[model samples]
Target: MNGNVPASTRTLRVLTFLATQPGPVPMERIASAVGLPRSSTYHLLKAMISEGFVVHLPEEKRYGLGVAAFEIGSAYLRHDPLERLARPLLAQLVAEIGQTAHLGVLHGRELVYLLKEQPPRPVTLVTDVGVRLPATLTASGRALLAELPPAQVRALFPTPESFVRRTEQGPQTLTQLRRILADEKRQGYAVEDSHITPGVASVASAAVDHAGHPVAAISVTFRTDAIPSSERFLLARRTRQAADALTRRLRG
Candidate 1:
């Protein structure tokens, strides 16, 4: 790595550092971490704050990655080759499973839908692109949750009181959530019924990124009463294959 990069490059590096840190990082800490002069660090921070890449907390006097950072980070999804590359795969999964397919990323304890493929049948689902759903109440959420560390999961939900039950079937507490995630991990995917909408069942698998983190989930939703016990295995297998294919595309 070059010790002396241009000012523009240094500013970019500072933003990168703040992004990877997860939470607020103080100006002095940023200076020390990036090995920049205090004056330069302050100037860079001020500029980034103005540009919305960083936010300054007047009360705490600490700096954190801002909404602009989140937007910019999410923008990567728009141009992401994985989503484009995975569309046909999602359609194929829906075709094979005879159910709706969805691709969602975990966003601050929520599942943000990135893409969805609807089945051709008369009965369909409402997992439209760009819709956000509760991560704790959906199979896709559980599938992604299964890959996260217990501490990270705890940090995401904070408390049992924060858990919102969408239906009688959903997990009502953190203990229940942890147990569900553990089961999903053991089973290699997550399965849930009538959690989001009564009479609907879903199964999801985690789509991992290059870091081996569960970046997203691929799910299939169908009418609970319609899916036979014999077809459940096929649905799970096809959903897993879609997730695996998406992960491979993402890694490439």
Candidate 2:
């Protein structure tokens, strides 16, 4: 539209705009937002859709991010920028709550710990940096899963074998897992009671990105007998607060 900008710049501009939107949008909206002519925008979108950087919804006549864009995001995670952003917050949570805290991210059907902070009280948790666990059984994983779309959840856990067990707790069926995720989503946080290690419980909240997808989870683990049900609410709120802070940092 204006003085000639490079096609590469225009492509990057379009991709940036799509990342900020809440969901799919008509081509006209993307064209108008990026200051491109309708025909040029159409051509650009066609090219992106072909490469898997954009997805075309023929029925709705709209476009959103595709698998390629997500793959790039996953590459970013490999560089551990999230772990850098989350370390201090995890340390603060441990200091304030006197509980072992962790930062975890979803990896396929499991959750991977990226950072862990333990208080001086010597609380021992099975999770540590680089540890992975079944997403359905851990509060950290559940918080991340609760924010995902239902269809995506179904795709991740289509059968009982997908629900690997660390203990006798957690959902064993897709129906039960969906119900558990719904309750966690409604409650604003996810909880685990001896789900990983007996006599230990954890609470977690998800840190979301600009598109409202969960990027990571913040969790705190404590001994069950040491804290009553009433105090658990306070811990849940604290984890949520840390997660919200992490989300803000991510958006920035």
Best-fitting candidate, scored by lDDT: 2
* Residue clash pairs of candidate 1: none
Model 1 alpha-carbon miss at residue 249, Å: 0.6
**lDDT (Cα, tens digit) per residue for candidate 2, span 1-252:** 574899999999999998887677899999999999999999999999888788777777888876567557654763568888898999998989888999888877888888889998758778998898998999999999898766457656768988887788899999999999999999999999998999999999999988898889999998999889999999999999999999999999
Report clashes for each candidate as comma-separated counts: 0, 0
Query: In TM-score terms, which candidate is top?
Result: 2
Per-residue lDDT, model 2, residue 15, is 90
**lDDT score for residue 241 of model 2:** 99
Per-model C-alpha lDDT, please? 0.78, 0.87
lDDT of 1 by residue, 5-114 (tens): 78888887887777566456678889888889888889888898788677776656678765466455545764567588778898888777667888887776778888
Candidate 2 regions exceeding 4 Å error are: 1-75
- Scored by lDDT, model 1 comes in at 0.78
In candidate 2, how many Å is residue 205 off?
A: 0.2
Deviation of model 1 at 45, angstroms: 14
lDDT, candidate 1, residue 246?
84
CA displacement after TM-score superposition, residue 223 of candidate 1 (Å) = 0.9
